[model samples]
Target: MSYFLLFVLAGFIAQLVDGAIGMAYGIINTTLLLSLGIPPVVASASIHVAEVFTTGISGLSHAFFKNIHRQLLIYLAVPGVVGAVTGAFVLAHLSERFAKTCIVIYLTLMGLFILYKAIRMKSTAKAAVTFKKSRIIPLGLLGGFFDVAAGGGWGPIVTPSLIASGIEPRYAVGSTNFAEFFVALFSTIVFILILGISVTSWQIFVGLLVGGAIAAPLSAYVARSIPRKIFTFIIAIAVILLSLRMMVKLIFF
Candidate 1:
C-alpha cells in the first residue's frame, strides 16, 4: 500500500513538472521509481505507459496554440520512431545498471546543455537560430534514441538542442512534444509486447491521463503568455535538478 501511494505521489508531482515545462516527467518519475526499488527496465516501461497519455494530450493542446513545423515533423518522425523502437528492444535485453548508467550520462549532459542555453538566452536578445530540416533529422534521431533507452526523457536532450539550433522556443517545445507523442506510443507498445502489462501500471496510466488532460491546456496557455526567458529559466532549472538526482543515484545510491 505504501509503495502504491509512493508511485501515486510521484505521478502527481511528475505530471505537474511535465505540465509546467513541457517535459521531464519520465526522467524524474523513472529515477524516483528506480530509487524505490523498481527494476530499471520495468520503471522505464511503466513510465512509458503513463507518458502515452500525457504526451498525447499535451501535444494536442500545444498544437492548437503553437505552430508545428509539419515538414520538420515529417522528416524527424521516421528516424525518431525507428530509433525509439530499436532502443526499446535493446532495453529489454540490457542489464539495469548498464541502462541506468546510460540514462545518467545522457541526463547530465542534457542538463548542462539546457543550463548553458538558458544562461545564453538570458544575456542575449538576438533572434533564435533558424530551423533547418538537415539539423532536425539528426537531433530527432538522437533524442528518440536516448528517450527510448532512458525511458522517454528525450525532451531535455532535444528541446535545448532545438532552441540552440535557432528554432523559436515555443515551436521548439511544441514540436518536441509532438515528437514525444510518437516516441511514447512506440515505447509503450514495445513494453506491452515485450514485458507484458500489469494492473498497477494501468492505474498509473489512468492517473497520467487525468493529470495530463487537466494540465496540457494550462501549459499551452502558460507557454504562450510567459516570457521566453522565464520559460527557458524554468526548464533549465528542471533539467539541472533532474540531472543531479540521476547523477547522485548513479554515483552514491
Candidate 2:
C-alpha cells in the first residue's frame, strides 16, 4: 500500500482504541512512522499536528454523548498545556529514552492495579466523588509533560489514574481524551517553533487526520455503549498489553 493509505489505516485503528480506552493513538502512529525511517522529531511533530484535529473531533464527540466531566476537563487542560510546552522544550534538549522507560514501567504497575480492581469490584458502582485539586493538578502536569517527552502519555497517565481514584471509567476516558487536544495543540506549536513545521510530511499529516476524524464519533459511541464491567476489563487488558509492548521495545529493541 502507499504510505498515505498505510497511515490512514494506522490512524483509524489507533484512534478506535484511543477514543474508547483513552490511550495509544500517538504511540501507535509515532512508532509506525519511526519504523518507516522518519526521524523521531519529525514523526512526533507530524502526529501531534494530526492529533490537533483528531483529538478535537474526539473530544467534541465525547461531549455530545454526555461522557465528559466539564469541570475535570478544565482542570486537566490548563495545567496540561503548560506542561506540554515545557515538555516540548525538554524534548529538544534531551533524550527521551530514560523518561519513556520510566513511564512504561509505571504504566505496567497501573495496569496491574486496574486489573485487580476490575476483578474485585462486584458492581459498576460509580461514586459521586469530588476530585481533589491537589491530586488532579499534579496528574495533569505529569501527563502533559510525559505526553511530549515520551511521545504520548496523556491518556496512559491520566485516564487510568482517574479511574483508579474512583471516577467512572467513561468520564475518566472522556475527560482525559478531551484534555489531550489542548496538550497536543500547544506541544505542536512549540515543536514547530523549535524544529520547524517542515519536519512533518504532508501525506502523513493528512492521512492520520482524516482517518482519526472518521473514527472519533464511532469510538465515542462505543465508550458510551459498553457495559461497565466489560469496559473496565477492556481498559485493564489494553493497558497491560500496551505497557508490556512498550517495555519489550524499551528493553529489547
Task: Return the top candidate by lDDT.
Answer: 2
Q: Give the per-residue lDDT digits (tens) of candidate 2, residues 1-253.
A: 8888888887888888899999889878877778888788767667878898999999999999998998899999999999988887788676788888888888899989988888887675664447988889989999999988877789998988888787888898899999999998888878777656554478888888888999999999999988777788888888888889888888898
Evaluate all candidate structures by whole-model CA lDDT and list the values in order: 0.69, 0.86
Model 1, 1-253: lDDT tens digits are 6666667767767765665566777766866787888777667556777777777777787778863566666666677887788777787676656666766676567667766766777544654545677887877777777676755547777776666565666777777777788887876687677757543555555554565566677776666676777777676676677667777867887
lDDT of 1: 0.69
The stretch of ten residues in a row with the least summed lDDT in candidate 1 is 198-207
Per-prediction backbone clash count: 1, 0
Residue 231 displacement in candidate 2 (angstroms): 1.1
Error of 2 at 63 (Å): 0.4
Clashing pairs in 2: none
